[model samples]
Target chain A: MSILLHDDTRVIVQGITGKIGSVQTKWMLQYGTKIVGGVTPGKGGQVVEGLPVFNYVEDAVKETGANASVFFVPAAFVLDAFFETIDAGIDFIVIVPEHIPVHDVMKMRDYADEKGITALGPTTPGILVPGKGKMGIMPASLFAPGRVGIISRSGTLSYEFAGILSEKQIGQSTVVGMGADPVVLCNLPKILAMFENDPDTDAVIIVGEVGGEQEEKAAEFIAGHMKKPVAAYIAGRFSPQGKKMGHAGAIVRGSAGTYEGKTGALREAGVTVLESPIHVHAWAEKYRLR
Target chain B: MRLHEYEGMDIFEKFGIPVPERGVAGTVDETLNIAEKTGYPAILKSQVLVGGRGLAGGIRPVQTPEECRTTAEALLETEIKGLPVREIMVCKKAVIERELYLGITIDGYSGRPVVVVSTEGGVHIEETARTSPDKIASFKIDPKFGFYPYQAVALLRRAGLDGKPLNACADILVRLYKVFRQYEAMIAEINPLAVLADGGLMAVDAVLEIDDSAMFRVKKMLSLSPEGRIGNRLERKGKEIGVTYVDLDGDIGLISSGAGLGMASMDIIGHGMEPANFLETGGGITADLLYKCMDLILMKPLRAVFINIYGGINPIHEGAKGIVRYIKDHGVTLPIVAKALGNHQEETWEILKSGGIHVVTEAATEKAVERLAALLNTSSPMSRS
Candidate 1:
């Protein structure tokens, strides 16, 4: 009942021969992600970590029924990799490469929207639906099957919150890394809506960095659609104002994407904002304990 | 990848847009030669990547060869936004009877590319927009049909341009689109498109930002990268130290993942610390990468080093190993601290413990800063042997 990845989602790794691809593939496999096959241009017939490698995504998808792809391709080739995956009918694509030119991101965003393929990020940590399939580079050990749905812009922060939830015997339905890119089309509110509708989910924890209208958008969504208790923590409180953050979309342009601004918005929308990352678990606990 | 005016003109010429005859000159002699060759009463513009050069006095009108030399010398000596002027652009000065602005760019806010035109041009467009919002006319360029010829024609006509100038403006608009499409430009601009006394149109100032993804097609564009534009002493030291640092106007110094982390780190800095420069070491932290990161942070004379890593499966241990290796290979002398969690945590800790680098690990951001503050308070900061 979780979002993005699930048990039956067979995944393919593009650029599987590259260092990052090879390393993450091993981890994904170790975590029991159904690594059906991989795609490497010239190294088609080679086998990597027991999984077969294909020359193209189409061949890999056809042969393995892999509907998802994790792109470990470099920035220069990311646009082509995205197009190739889309052309090959891959439904979901997680792009981990960061530092792509802004213009390239604009085109990639346009293309992804046009195709309706759930494009996660150019610098995202990927998605994880607990006790099921894992994609991107999220630490699988932090996640346990639970009812708390978590979504964040930072990868490690998600792990920290998830670990906190896990320690308290509270598992997660899903955790999404929305990336640092400005596009917040699939943000916390959207995920919250899905989690709220899911019978297995009881509460939601939104971990947001200061930047963009994403938190505001999520707050609006939560205000309207979300009936379940939502606990939230927005990072970058100590961050300097009017500074650009790590993500392309995370910059605090004027008042937008600021931690204070986001927290204010979330609070106005009836979200119980945590004072610190550690407080997220405490708030969730109080809601459960009550 | 924002292109300098010279690069923008090159694309403009290719698309048949009428820009003032211009050539980039690195020396006063070259400036004089270009001014003479292009004919006198020319404009010598400092070739820098940043804007506000006009206010900074980087743009000058040279009526004589002596004036060209003085202007070029003045420009080369001056620094605009931390970039020293190395080259000055010598361009033929047209009799600008009227100044109009024209630009085609992606409106990131709207999630679509748009064509912006204005009758008021010579001044900063942003300032003008805030002052006289009604003077600017903007039209969204649909990706399906792009900037239509009729839209361009109508836009110019509405902007108080008519007759030959309107036709010329339309032609330039069409050409600008070609340049934008050909080079995969994110922003193609011709500020103050002058209506000469003779009723002809000429672009006086241009700026183009090429899409980095399309670098494969424009391979030669790498040679014209802003790296050689205006390098500072700090940047040079950073380069020497093997870190990638950009001097920023903030108290907190950031060194993080190449683009995403770098950007996120900056936002985090702004959100958490103070206005700071973002130093992205791109990915794959080598001893060299860490050195570059540290050097960039030091170059800005940052008070603290905020090393935040969300290196998923990228292995924090490898990153920590790089940092430890950097310390062992080249001892650092600065107030540094970072937070790393995930992937190679155990192995990363092993490297830190075995290396004995005196690294601090805390879940609290305050503790991380406290450790950095404590290091800064030391009488003699640890010196690299």
Candidate 2:
């Protein structure tokens, strides 16, 4: 009953031969993700963590019926890998690398849109469906099966929130790290729509940060469409303007991407916006979301 | 990665987009030489990265060699927004019949490159876009097919351009699109694409910001303006080590695993206590690399250091080891507050405690910040030997 990923969502790892890919593949496997195969150019027929490797995604797709992909490819090769995955008819993809060229990200996002595929991130930790399946690099111990669907723009912050939720015995349904890139494929609104429809998700937690209008737009969508209770925690409230605070997307340009703007919008949307990550548990308890 | 006007014009010239003959000058002699070459009625533009150069009087239209000398001297001495004017761009002033705007930038919402054209040009485009949105015409370019001629023509025509101006604007737009694509630019703008009195089109002002991530692909373009790499010593050192470190006006040295986490840490360290710098060690960094990052953060005068790590790809133990090694080797006596979560958290806690470091066990950053603030309030500032 997860939002994007489930137990039978057969996944394949792209760039599985690389150091990060191999490590994450093992971690994803350990988290009970149904990793079917892997793809690494010139490394076909190789085995990584007992999964078969193919030179191309098409081969992996054809042989294993892998409908999802997790790209651990370098930033330079992300576009090519993305195109290949799209062409192979993979429905979902998680791009793990950060600092992907904005142009390439745009193209990948546009192509993914045209093809109707769910491409997650260029700098994301991917998605986690607690006690079921995980497709990202998030620590598995921090999650538990619950009714709250969590969506965030950060990996570490997602882990932090999940840890808080786990500590409070407030489990989650699915957690999606939309990546902190300025141009991400699955924005807050799109993921919110999915969360709104999921019956297993009684409430949703949005971990938003400064920069970009995604949070504002998400608030707009929630105000109009959302029926379930939602809580939010935004980072970078005290971050200085103009200076990019690590994330490519987390910059306060003029008044467009400020914490106040985002928080105001979310509060107006009937969402309980928490002042800190630890307060999410208390807020969730107050809301009485089972 | 934002190119100066002179550098932007260089790229425009390479793409055959019409630009007024221009030369960059660092000295009064160089300014005089370029002024002579470009002839009288030249424009002296200070080449600083920040905007509002025109409002700051960094741009001066000089009529004579004497005026050029005085203006260039004054501009070179001036500082716009705290950034000194290191160089001035001297160019032949174009006769403007009409000023138009043409720019290619990524639309954050659509996740696509967009070409924005406006007949109401030269003034604050942001203001125009905010207030009079209908004054400008925007065309989203599909990156797969790129900016087509028909799309450019349609946008230009919609912006009240017709006949010669329309075709000329279309040509420049296409050429600008090429430059945008070729250089992998985040923003390629000709704020005032001036149409001269004689129906000639020229880029009066140019701004091109290349995507910093695409630097590896455009080494030659970067090498052309190596001196443009402007930052402090810590930033430069961070760049060298494949990390991001931005100096701030605070006393608490901070380090975190992810960019979002780093920024969130900075935000949580509230109550008038600013973070000294923003440091993201990134994922899967080794203990040695973390030690180097600690060394950079420790270089600054700090009352306390807050190390927050939520290990996903980056193991908490590695960060703990790095901090332990740094403390043991450097004998850093500054009051330090650390919070480690995720993989190997127990071991990481044990290592830091064994190294005689007090670790903040609060999982929430807000509580951790409160703990750090309380610790700092109780202990006097350490005297650096």
Candidate closest to the true structure, highest DockQ? 2
i-RMS, each model, one decimal: 8.5, 7.3
Instruction: Please write out the lDDT profile of model 2 over residues B1-385, one tens digit for every residue.
Output: 7777887887798889999988989899999999999988999988988766787788889999999999888998888766778899998888898888888877687787778888877756666665665667878777777677788999888867787888878989999989988898878888788989999899988888888899888767654555635566788788778788887888899988988888778866755588899988877578888888889988878998888887687777876888889999999888887888777888889998876776876567776777677787742221110
Residue-wise C-alpha lDDT for candidate 1, range B201-298, written one tens digit per residue: 88888877766556667756435744454356665565555445566667767666534345434443353355356555545665456655554555
Stretches of candidate 2 exceeding 4 Å from the true structure: A243-256, B161-164, B378-385
lDDT tens per residue, model 2, A1-290? 88889767999999898888898899899888999999999999999999999999999999999999998888898898899889998999998888898888888887888889897887888999998888878888888889988998989999888887787778899999999887998778999999999989999999989877888899899999999999888888877666321111211123557888889989999999887677786788787754
**Alpha-carbon shift of residue A105 in model 2 (angstroms):** 2.0
**Count of backbone clashes, every candidate in sequence:** 35, 0
Q: Whole-model Cα lDDT per candidate?
A: 0.70, 0.83
Span of ten consecutive residues with least summed lDDT in model 1 chain B:
B376-385
